[model samples]
Each structure stands twice: as C-alpha cells, then as structure tokens.
Target: MRQIGLVIKTEGNRAWVKMQKGASCGEEHCPLSSSLIDDSQDDFYTVCAINSVGAKSGDQVMVEVEDLFLLRTAFMIYILPILAGILSYALLNYFLKIPSLTYTGTFLSVGIIAILLKRADRKLNFPYRIVELGTASVCISCPLKNRNEQQKLKP
Candidate 1:
C-alpha cells in the first residue's frame, strides 16, 4: 500500500514519518509503523523511510510498504555486510591465526569488499532513494529492495 505522510523525525540513517493515512485530528494520537526505525513523538511517531522525497517536517509523502517481515529482513540485509566484514576481520587474526596478513591488509580487504558490495548494490530496486536536490551525482541505490525498479525511485 502507498501512503502520503509527513516526516516527523530523523535519526541515525533513518527518518520516521507519521503516515497521513492513519492521522485524524480528533484521534489525539496517530499510530504509525516504521520501515526502518521508529522515532515518534507524543502525538505521532517517526517513519524510517529513505529521504527520497526530500520529505521534511510536515511535508506529505507517498510510501509503499511490502510486508512487515520483508521490511525487517530488508534492514538486516543492509546491515549484514558491515557485520560480516567486522566479524571476519577480527576472527582472521585473533582466532584463525593467519598472522601473516597485516592489519593494513585486513583494513584494505574490508574496504575493497565494501566497495564491491556497494557496486553490486547499485543494481537493486528498493522502495526509496534520496532525491537529489540539484545534481544526480550523489544518488545511491536503496539497499532494501530488488534491482529492476531502482530507477523508478526518487534517485
């Protein structure tokens, strides 16, 4: 379902929007679901979609949610790479005892792996992307979705 909402809060890599769909003046408080993070206030909770619409406080937004479980897993996928890199790097030396590889090598390897993952990540078709203010240079793929509908997103 697609929703038109307003951004209520911004927190560590996530923005919480109080979906207009669930808002009612007489309701006193609006209940919201966050795709990434929940940072809501007394009357409203924040949404956690990407800053694609350039959605600011009080700005209306159109959002599409797939599935609740899917949303949770999507977030996991985005975080797994960094976790893997950190875990592997730490284990490679302290536990694996492949001491021949220097710390520089570990860092370099992590960087290279991250770069490669990011390059591959560009092909995904996620629900959101930060819409560029002017130039299209800083647009990044939504790490939360598939690859075909990518261009259909804001960035």
Candidate 2:
C-alpha cells in the first residue's frame, strides 16, 4: 500500500510524516487513526517511518507498506471487537443463562477490547518506507507547494 504524506520533520533514520485523513483511501488501515498514537487534536495525524528515500522536511513523499500488513491490521481493528463480543455473549449466556446479562457482557467485552486495541495501536509500528519523493500527487493545492509559491512571490 502506498500513500502520500508530507515530511513534517526528520530524526536520524526516521521521518515523521504528516498524513491527511483520507476517508476513502480504500482498505489501507492507517495506524495513526488511533487517538492514543497522537496527543494533538487535529484533523491530520503524524506517523514515523523509515527514511529510505532521504526525504527532507516539507517534501511530499510516497510511503510504501506491505499489503499483508495492512490486511492484518484491518482485521485486528475491525474484526477483533466483533469476535470478542460474540465470545463474551456465548460464555456469559452459557454460565448465567440470563439474556440481559449476556448482552451487557457482550457490549462490555467489545468496549474493553476496543480500548485495548487503541492503546496497543500506539506502539504498533507497521513497517513502512519512503519510496518516492516529489510524486505527481504533490499538486498546487499542497501546503508545501503553496509555501514555495508564496515565498517566490514575496520580495
């Protein structure tokens, strides 16, 4: 999977890339979507990736990650909660034989699993690389591009 991001900063071998929230970017499971990963409250999120392309700050870079990795992440994020709920309901119903208790257990299990996943996601670094720099996706509307144009126009 490949996505475009702006290199916000660089530290040694890793580059912190600011990613836009692409609601329709297919099945690519963005690990940074978890609030535990970023403390900042904003529409965008930042992620750390290996600086294979030696990209500098403000560069529009194409990041690459394995398809299988994304698939596993998606499953863990989307499917695990449902599975926990089903398992909780089954266990609770069998042991207690109460309908309301079973439903409550199911909901509680799902919420607990979700919270765990969110916390774990903070440390889950899906391996990614900065494959290409200055890709065609960097258009005039891009922040770095507009900054360059504005500087050129001044003085």
- lDDT, candidate 2, equals 0.74
The per-prediction CA RMSD against the true structure, in angstroms, equals 15.2, 5.9
Please give each candidate's TM-score.
0.33, 0.72
Local distance difference test values of all predictions, in order? 0.49, 0.74
Q: Write the per-residue lDDT of candidate 1 for residues 1-155, one digit (tens) a residue.
A: 34444456655555666543233222224333332234442333334677765555554455555666446644555665567667767877786576666465577766776787667666654454333322222223222123254322221
Query: For model 2, how does the per-residue alpha-carbon lDDT over 39-101 read when each residue is reduced to its tens digit?
Result: 665546667899988999988787778999989998999899988988999899999999998
Best by TM-score: 2
Q: Deviation in angstroms for 133 in model 1?
A: 25
